[model samples]
Target: MKDWPGPVSTCWNHWIAVPTGDQAGVMEVLSLSSPTPITFAEAQEVIDADAHGNPDDRHHLSRVFVTPEVDSWTLVIGAWCNPCDSERHEDVLRLCKALSARYGGAQAYYYGEQGDGSAWLVAEHGSVVRRYAATGELDDELLTLGDPLPQEQARRLELGLPADGDPQAASSEQIEEWTWAAFHLAPEIAAAYGVSPFTLTREAKVRGTGVLALTPDAASHGI
Candidate 1:
């Protein structure tokens, strides 16, 4: 994570922390805050009514929205599990890398473990960000506005996966399977928008270029 200089504003204020099991209710609050008063049951109905079908949709509903207090505006998503843990950390890292490469750096932000066992990635361009952990906190400073994954780390991320596979190699069914696993393993954030899961997996390969294409330029050695 890139270090901020001084007393940054508080972005945590815009974040609405919901209980582990209250994701549906929270989403309802967000969705139904208009003229109509939506009750918990009504919100569940709307979620269930989606055409894609809900196969345990509850797991995909965990998340909070953060509005930053400083110049570098951002929304931070906390990781539900320890990012260093072999289980889902790699997936989180991969997604951040792809997002950074696609957006040209500083467009997204991610933090792993440090302050808390939380990892969050933000894509400010879309006005949509996802958080998975219960303890993730938001900083007040919105200093940089591009890729949060540094050049060095981005280079490593670009080399971590294969780039020559078939574009249609992973079928939707296969992708769905991985999505299900991701939702279950980290049941604190919603992984899908429509039929797509927010996090990318080996099987899905949603971000096109693959590992090699995303890598940064080699450093020049000075004599």
Candidate 2:
């Protein structure tokens, strides 16, 4: 086992994590095109370049990068690869299902600091196991799937949320509190499910290599 120098902030906003070292398999599942192996340094360069108007049609509309193998997990990063950006739980479940079909399991997370929102979804063997999201801008549940994860259940209990979310029985302040709990849970939820990319520290074991790839959606358009 070896320690990573540190984690970069680019992945803090959105990322999909599949528990596997097979970067090719993850890229294949994503339908990514023209993958070129690159170090984390080069991966950061690709992201930075795309941000400053790299003017390369090769990436089409977005750039997606895969992280070097981190222990048993490989992370995929891109704004287009998120539920927070879409504000759609279905997108998270769909992508997780696709990745899980090939990788056995997948976890997707999103955190929008400006929006003060966060979302997380877990899928396994082609089925979504759980999903949750909150932006604090809606009264209705933005999204909730399956059941609460153990850590979530514990958090809810600690915060006094009942096992059954009966809004009818709760007061306005209580509802607001619960809604607040929903935001900013990506890190905790991710920690419980798998690796939390942004917080990865020296203790994490990394191997193989990462890469930059053109997204399939963009590449298919002949860019």
Candidate 3:
């Protein structure tokens, strides 16, 4: 395997199951639209490697996997980001829109910061039914539409730690401990939340506290 340069910031993993009949069509569409040309086997390999090599940074790999499903298809995309830039945030949104347009029922998860963030988006026929964001500390509105702001369930999960035990809590070590834990646990809960595990992990670190507590729009979207 080749070693990547620079501080690893973002990673993504996605899986989609299509009908055997549509397998060829799905591959063609993904190949044509994606910024990079990746084969099904290659994508799987990347996921496996990232999952094992650095489970913590699995979102940075930006990997996607597709397979054969029943009638239509199922898609899953995962991502991770560094948590400082905004351009990376936009790239993730663009990728989601493109894939959702190609497949009927699609879902996406974005993680990480602005410039070095990672994201994943996938669909079966042509519509996006689910979306998730794990990016730590950055803006939540960048990934979703409308108001109401999303809630960071991943963050909540992390905060679930014993209030006094959490480093961010009054009796804890740091104020951001709860947030960091959230980002770390994001990948583990990605499937349940339909969001990027990596992004959630990063968001935990920078999420604010106190009277100005910010909630992820996803939280209000009904989880």
Candidate 4:
């Protein structure tokens, strides 16, 4: 195990689950088409009206980047809110579902910011399969969420997290280098989500350990 890197900035934590594929694999399936840009006048006005604008700043729906080491794609949306905001949460879900549908119903990952309590969700089509909330609340409504392997479950059991606690605290225990967790996505499920399970697993192994999963068994029950 490597030394714990002090404390992380909880103001913006990331949560993501891509079609069981490497960065390239997931990226290939995802629609990376840039969000329609605002008209030049509107963009300039928004930037100028806000005293905070810098000459280089521009308005956009979200900013995107790839973590090749983790085999996931991340998007930093302009919307910001606390975990308890139902409106924000719903908006996020809608966005995630749309993203998933773009890839022919493949599973999509969403990592939303909520100050020190970020949230992550894995969705197929419009249905949420797995949810990991950092707001000290456990979401068990989605039973279709997949299962973790024995080793994954056992490691989660060892964490012994507290009720009404942040799942990331438990996550810190399992991380080595940059890895969080990786779940074995089933082939059929992957197909439903329009992805290849074989490629997902292959990419995960090749990427080392930046990927991770928080199943209902571990994330909700802390088992």
Clashing pairs for model 4 are 20-200, 21-200, 106-193, 157-223, 179-209, 181-211, 181-212, 181-213, 182-212
Query: Between the candidate structures 2 and 3, which one is better when assessed by lDDT?
Result: 2
**TM-score, cand. 1 vs. native:** 0.23
The C-alpha stretches of model 1 lying farther than 4 A from their native spots are: 1-61, 66-70, 80-82, 106-223
The TM-score-based order of candidates, best leading, equals 2, 3, 4, 1
Tell me how far the alpha carbon of residue 60 in candidate 3 is from the true structure, in angstroms, after superposition. 11
TM-score, each model?
A: 0.23, 0.82, 0.37, 0.34
Residue range 18-63, candidate 1, lDDT tens digits = 1122322322323312123232233233323421234244221232
Candidate with more favorable, higher TM-score: 2 or 4: 2
Candidate 2, residue 68: CA error in Å? 1.9
- Which stretches of candidate 4 lie above 4 Å from their native place? 1-11, 14-85, 104-115, 137-155, 160-223
List RMSD in Å for every model shown: 20.9, 3.8, 15.0, 14.9
lDDT comparing candidate 4 with the true structure: 0.33
lDDT of 3 by residue, 79-182 (tens): 22211135344444444445556543344443433322333333334544333343453664355442111234334444454432332434353335544543
lDDT of 1: 0.26
- lDDT against true structure, model 2: 0.70
